[model samples]
Target chain A: MKKILIVATIFFNINLLFAQSSIPSVDVKDINGNIFNTSQISNDGKPIIIDFWSTSCKPCIKELIAIDENYEDWKEETGVKVYAVSIDNTRSVNRVAPLVNGKGWEFEILLDVNSDFKRAMNVVNIPHRFLLDGNGKVVWQHTSYAEGDEEELYELVKKLAAGESLEEKH
Target chain B: MKKIILLFTILAFTFSSLQSQNADLGQIHGNFQMDAQLYNNDSLIGANVPSEKMGLNSYANFNYTRGKFNAGIRYEGYFPALNGFDAKNNGVGIPYKYASYTSEDLTVTVGNFYEQFGNGLVLRVYEDKALDYDYALEGVKLNYKPYKGVYIKAVYGKQRYYWNTGTGLVRGIDGEFAINDIIEKLADKKTKLTLGGSFVSKYQADKDPIYKLPENVGASAARINLYRGKFSLTGEYAYKINDPSGVNDKIYKPGEALIVNATYSQKGLGIYASAKRVDNMSFQSDRNADGKDLNINSLPDITKTHSYALLAMYPYAIQPNGEIGFQAEVIYKIKKKSLLGGKYGTTIDVNYSRVHNIQETQINDTIAIGESGSLGYNSNFFEFSKEVFFSDLNIEISRKFNKKVKATVVYQNLVFNNSVFNNGNYHKTIYSDVAIADITYKFTSRKALRTEMQWLRTNQDKGEWGMLMLEYSMPHWFFSVWDMYNYGNPEENKQVHYYYGAVGYINKANRIQIGYGRQREGVICAGGVCRYVPASNGLSVSITSSF
Candidate 1:
């Protein structure tokens, strides 16, 4: 009877673990070392842009820099904020500061050095971007970067920022 | 909290399905590819694993969608990974899982993922299934667009290693705005162009007392992509700071790496050229690193990995500590209606790449972190050293004689440093030649017979070899058999052979295959990525399905 109870307990625990594996929330820490829970970073009445990228991807850089160059102008027009997450590990951590400072970017920068945040999101490739709305609901996403893709991304962001009902794209 | 997440998943699925109901929602679609083999270890042939064996390897991706959101997962089961990738196989759970929601310009993903930045010289998180690898991050991603052609993103997460998270934490930020999207002048056809740039950085702690590494490092890049009707050019210049500790023998030289790639593509003709120079930049998770030893921050030698059997054997490994290299590839298609072109037409590809060590000096006898000028030896760029790390020169020609017959011939010359690429003793250079012929006969619209023949010759390293395969694939079933014969060897005792056969059945979303054969010993590299797999022989099976 004791063995049976122990086996039952083991299975129960495994089930519990697997159940919690879906959409696990995380206390994200940005490059500033400030811990921001999901609620703190989420936009209340506006759309949020979340880009999961690393310092080593060429295409991800292209996508990110293109947005940064016009970020100030974008915010004035749409009032949207981008939360950039870095997945660099110990070895490449040293390059983080200089690179960001030199580029003069103004996005909300965070760190996932241990990749805890990345795992929660189930990211398969860099330049992985996700769009969330005022209700903290995901609205759009894409997996790769191609020329002129940003234009499509902007049209969606603009509609969301304007508080207009989003018409699904076919 | 758990209920909320579950509700989110259900809602996301429901929404995506609603939108995709008539457009293939709830339907599964993805790519399936594999490379299997057989091995024979003859006692007199100096085989590493002397046993008759066979192996099967494959990867499959499945997706299910609802209305405004979707959930997808990848299933990869390799019964004894490919020839040289025994280490990547960790007998465990499914390697991928994720649920996402997207509507218009806003998107969110809460699960595992992958990412990267400029040239990956400073940071990159990705997965190449062909190499039996997956580097997905686990987290929540948000993407927002504020303007017509501008976008921003924020992600918080951890990287995936097999089924678990990596040791250190990872975080970053990146943004891009389109010029042509916002400016009317830039959108004109006469000067149609788009220019963008990005800055990204990662952070981790120096937990081990062995090295006083930076707590937070940021890397950035600038790029411009100009495109017209038939001509396009994209280029990015990146820079990183001095990262010193254990990886570089405690050498205090700052990690400096740069890469530039430009490509021009036309209707049937394409040209790609890239160049890179790196100095004292052995970027790795553990400062005390070993060849083929990766713990994250692995920027494989930017040098191209050749495809020819010989050139690929000793393929060049990027000298992260110091190296310079460039690669150029041109692909041209022969027009069918033009003179000198046959009825079916042909395509020709020529590619070449080479790399050498970069020179630098130590500023002080003991180089410390953050110390700028004269910290390490400095040398002129574009200089070549006595050591020729890696080089590849090859050309491939493919011609389709008819609907049932096609052939491809490749000739290549390669110089590889076994010490650098193999993480083993002895630096060996090898020369090789490879030829392949494939033909197919379609018995009906749903059934076909295909055959392939390949031969690889070498003078150094392992030996000379030949391979032949015949595949009979129909609507629901397929079978294949192949043989690899080691005909010539510099070492009389190193001549061995291998053969393998496999058959599978495909019914819509499900497929199964099984095989047994001998495996060879070599490094398998695809798309500038590589892994070492050991020789093994065993029975393998695969099954995939969706609900």
Candidate 2:
């Protein structure tokens, strides 16, 4: 009888939580020592790109560097922002700054010391990328770093940035 | 009535959420999965399980994350397990529960988790589904990165014993450094190197009134990996102190192992080879454990996992306590337009593997450690032992003809030891050859037909076998028929086993397959995940989907 009540309470809470859902909110610390609110990262309801990556992941680093090479052009054309979230925990955390500095990556970087943000985003494998619309709703997600994948990503980002409804793409 | 209502409510909720576009509850999306099976008695093939009437197994996992915080729960279920398995598991329970936080340079995980240190020679906690094996640890793990290219981890945990904890505690530390990244000035597109090392120890409170046993047993290993252009090399060596209990008995013995591998690949060609030597490295819980008996940590040998249907039937079981083995594999693709490449190009794969006992002393007397006397007599290292464990030589070729058709052919030769590898009362030696040919032809852009034929011949073990398969598929539907004819079995009369197969489909995310066949009981490992599926002569159905 006691166990039954406990299970019922838990289910009730889960159902309630599911009903009041909105854009996911996360707190992340940037590499430059600034706490950035993920829900408010992009201004004027612009589309945001979140790249979950780690230094040990070869494909992630390559993808980031490749994007960095063309980041300036992408921003000028689409007015978009890319948040490279470093999922490197304590075991690989110290390498985060050195890796970024060494690679000359100039994107906004945040540290989720406990993977608090990674879990909120449902990231199982890296490098996972999520595209958010102006209202901060996840519109698209893809896992793994592959060649030419970023090209397709940029096309979607541009479409969202143009205020074009991207819900049909999913 | 109440139970049915609750179940219906649950199903309705599940269905409704699956149909909704906003089903994801916040940033974390999680789901649970489980699979179970029951074994029925069959006099044929000697599977007359009397008391062991039914077998059940299940597992569920939950994942949640928000920002830098992540947590998960894994619940496992087992009831009256299969033969040779412990029956202590009879209910649903939490085998693994953990919460972890990752910062820029630091991560901490508290609770139960699986980990491996340096090829798992000293410490490894893992699960093999095919083997009905799950060894998880309840512990706390810490990872710290002090600098670029350097990482360190410290972990402490107690192994799980059914619903309880093992008597022993395991502690380990591992560190790795990538020199190429650390010394960026010397880094280029050409040269790279990574170095790692680990130390692990296990401790159990002494509880003996007569013989004294070491309270603590420890092992350490170091590894190096170098890569330049198309060449790569990796090697690790580990050593553990002598602590023989049940498995080794009154005989006191230490353990040591060496593993080395090298590979070079470029363009359309790839080649790899690996060799390992182990001596008295069988570390387990309850030293008295025998076949189908274990209470603690046991590391499975790292060896090539065969892929061919027959080549994999009797896979090699690493003899960590005493064994020497090597494997070599090569893959090549005939370049298109080349003289031998033909019009559509061809891909060929070749693999070979072998294992044997290591040199050992047959001394009957106990030798004290560090004594001036030689511990044991020296024996030949490369010579084959009286027992042949396992051997395999296989090759496969695949080709594409135009855009409508593709075909592949596979052939393999295998040698399986029945007495040691299988639970046969006598030496079951099987020398066999198998061949399979598969072809796929497309009639339209989204319609296709696939056909397969396989033949296997042998004079030992399960005897001769043959298989035929046909498949037809469209955009949202697929149908298949498969038959496995067991032309022979060493213990049973030669008879052909026929299996009919059929399947219904939705989209890629949902499909249901039903089949009736003489399913061979064996271990199946995919991407390092393993599970044991028992042999059954009944209907088999599978349904899977992900939204």
Candidate 3:
């Protein structure tokens, strides 16, 4: 039975070569404990930034704070939406909402307690950022963060919102 | 061997089809990481002399995804492993691989997988590389959601132990239901409720001569979550049947755990409180395994996780056998224009946590507190013991002085029972006060400098210590230097200076860092899980890239 299933899976995946890049339809929970499908995330043709973070990661917190400090300017310049995904697991999941509320960050916070979405996205480290185009295709991705990394991210967001291809320069 | 050939064949066929079709071909993405260290002996700080004098750990992951189908594999290598890592990890190959398919209402996964059920009180399969821990289950898993707001998951597997599977088999199932979503009328209401339950069991052959042990150990948990506007409460209760294991000294004692959390938050203020009690709740896949090995469940710690070097010197380690703990925190932001707020407003956070040994009474006058082949001990579920294991109170304040300057200050008071947590000869309690100040100044839009000064005062363990760190960063490059000095040790010869320097470069999706440092022997912790890091003088290099 297992061999048959493996063969069947291989055949099905072979035909999937022509599929477009779309967000994985994994289930994630909001701060209020409501489940939502990742494929349903849309901002009406605006580009989106998904940040993978955890409560214990200092670099991740620093990156999010930097983005938060300049969030209004980025939104005003380009129709960009930032979603902060917390992969805190059960060990630190309880502290996530309080931390987000305390920081006064205006980004949508999603909980990936089991890291389903993180594993699906192949994120190996905290502070991993994914830039999704208006059509929900991932156009650019970066890992790690320094002091001035948010500016680079904002520039890409502007280019993406303007319907420019990221593959050329970035 | 056959599986490897099959995997390669599939990959080759997939790529060939992609080239011929000239289609989207889905996506193939992965990441690579390598950490190498050259060690030197330092007798003063008890640094061990490694026979190899160097170690390397590396891994490369490849993931392929196409709509509803996905597959991945991780290849790992450890040349004699790191100095402090388990020697058993000296060699490695493909420790993790998985294939999965998902539809609108159902998902199926085979091969190696990681999973958790209901806050992981009952079961969890995960990997933490820093701890040299990877217990991914070689398993079959299924997730079925027949209706809105309902989720059901089933898993059967044997955990991975080094290059081989553990001696025990694990099986579990979980179900969750959201009341508001399940009932249409309540969907639009403000209040929401979720209920969940799980049952997990592990089977191992009993081969002890002194006592009779159960072959199948079972654990179950029930949880509830309620949310209304800005207030929310969540709780879970778990129970296990009598199971003898090494951690509990082979005692046939039933285990129990309860965790409750409540929170209320608004725009500029957040409040949270949580309490937990665990009694003899150490569940493991292998009955004889100990430490961070072959664990099937996770016990949440109530202590606040500190990020500062000095503040984290003495971290809390969960005593899974029996512990009762509680934590409370409040975060408030002062209005911008107020006197204490300054121009950009100030935020303050206050947190406190405490844990104690659970009250236990001996079964008989001479049986002692816990004995083998016994029920361990009897105790009142809500009783608190007079002995305190750990306590901490901390406060932090942050403010932006100007567009170019920002500062943060923190103070912490901690009481750690070294005798209980460390299990060493020093049986005295440690009382310490730590202070930290962090300041950052942006030289320009693309340049910045940050500094951290920390002081820890304690007369018990290592005495008073001080640390200073300075960092300079540009758009893609960063350099840092730090030194920690233990100046007040009673034994003058033991006082040492631990210094470190590092440089890093980051590109689009890649980073490389190199550092030379004298590390102080201490406990490093992540989410209350503590590991002892041996002192060492070493040069380390790390590289990470994703594509």
Candidate 4:
């Protein structure tokens, strides 16, 4: 009845949106305790990869370690930047800085204490990753990490860097 | 046929009108997840098939964002619910919906939202689906940034209790000020500070037959933070007025809590210390609700969350009535080419934590310690009780060997109090030791194999246990199998093995996994929150997608 029509109208509107989308704006903080917007996640026309993680997720640490081991080469070859965002709450948020420094990860770090950015991105799982093209359009996205998954991530970065289409637009 | 035609006509008309007005049609983003399980009767583990042969739980969310306005709706369904979840989640419905708009310095949200104020000491409205706990407030929330470095918010709503809202009305407001951000001169200084405070209260009609209960209860908290070069400190204290509730044995004692943490970090080295003391600090929106229902705030955990199967067997449940705990951790990395560190270097992590019951004495000679309708007890702010609740000490070492192999080893010793978690069934204290080893071998740039071995030795409770697992993964697929063996059970016939296997596929932002296993009864905890799950033999399948 009435509910059916309401759901239908919204469904149609969503289906009609086909253009490439850019990152949504949401408030987040840097490790230095500065509040900023997610739209500021930029690489100056270079490619960018954003990884959502938490302090207690074991798989996330493993993936980040692997990426760090190969980050220098990736930067030199593709000019791709990495931003690792921690979705820790107020209490655990303090651990993010120490953990990152202890692990010696050189990627840019952002803290999403209330998970505002995570909710905006519709990310339900940690280690959810997204690769944006030079235009800030999310050209590729992934969830979960297997042992060699970073290599596949690099493949998509290589294409996006070369101005190639990910063919992920739906 | 008529519905389809109307749907298309309305779609076409709205699409054309909206398309002609704005260049950006806005963006639609959402995520969906479904988990279903088919159960079987297994006598060995006390698992019995439910009347429903199968159980399914699913949730989907759709969010639309256009410029400064965004709206979303979440639909959750649990067909008779899974074995572990409460029976209340047996129907299907739209449990969450919201619309919000943001202006320069103000944002308004209506319908439903989640919020937290200053370490969540007094107020934190949130949802954690895995634990089947969601307290999403259904009402209005307003946020205002009146100044450069000041943020204030107010909320009024009733907590969602399963399919409906709770009987109580909840309201709260919070504000925070960043001194350095507000004062331009202090922006560039070496030190920084922030101050925050919150006040929250709940109201419900009192209709008790035997006792007179307070219809309105209020709680408040204040916090401060400090940051300097390579070091940071944070502390929060909360206090609540006298109130009687079902969870606290109906005692009319005021509540109080204190939490403090400090940390210092440098390259390849990190040190942390934290302490918390909670005494009758449980605050619930509903005066007579079940345990953990309609909770107004989240109590922070001062212990680490272990990922190992054996080490996490007996998890810590927050002692809402009264307890004190402390934790310390250090992480350091060894230089490459050093004697202890191989060619690729090594990382070592050490952590320790302990919890003790808070000392309590009689309020007077006329009343019992925890008698209903009486002042619970008198507790000194810094006194330690004679009984120990829990303790753990663990260390981990991770290293890389060549370009294809990486490994990690960990050892832990822990003590658990059975009386606390078992509802006073047995007050025996149990001690256990655990060891785990994980290794991975890369076959190519996109292929790898991993293995894990874990063992736990103990002289109490279930005695000893062992586990082994092996997994293989490619760029888009993974397969794994493992088994937990309780081989040292006191009764020979009770020794049993809980084995499980799973295979999964991942493509871009979509994943599907299927698993079959004999799950052992245990509690799963995250951030000090816990959920009890029963042992079962079942085939489980799950699918998750995000766009």
Docking class of 3: acceptable
User: What's the interface RMS deviation of candidate 2?
Assistant: 12.5
Best by DockQ: 4
Model 2 Cα lDDT, one tens digit per residue, B323-385: 777777777777666777666566777778777767565554565322222333334545556
Candidate with the larger DockQ of 1 and 3: 3
Per-residue lDDT of candidate 4, residues B475-545 (tens digit):
78999999999999998887999999999999889999999999998899877788988888999999999
Candidate 4 chain B minimal-lDDT segment of 10 residues: B1-10
Clashes of 2: 42
As a TM-score, model 2 comes out at 0.72
Flag clash pairs in model 4: none
Q: Tell me, by TM-score, which candidate is best.
A: 4
Candidate 3 yields a Cα-based lDDT of: 0.88
Task: Give DockQ: model 2.
Answer: 0.06
After superposing candidate 3, which stretches have Cα over 4 Å from the reference? A1-21, A168-170, B1-24
Pick by lDDT: which candidate is best? Answer: 4
Tens-place lDDT per residue, model 1, B273-345, is 7777776655544334343333334453444444333345554544556777777767677776566547656
Compute the lDDT for candidate 1: 0.58
Q: Which is superior by TM-score, 2 or 3?
A: 3
Identify the superior model by lDDT, candidate 1 or candidate 3. 3
Q: Residue A90 CA error for candidate 1 (Å)?
A: 23
- Cα deviation of A144 in candidate 2 (Å)? 16
| Model 1 alpha-carbon miss at residue A62, Å | 32
My TM-score estimates for the predictions, one after another, are: 0.64, 0.72, 0.94, 0.95
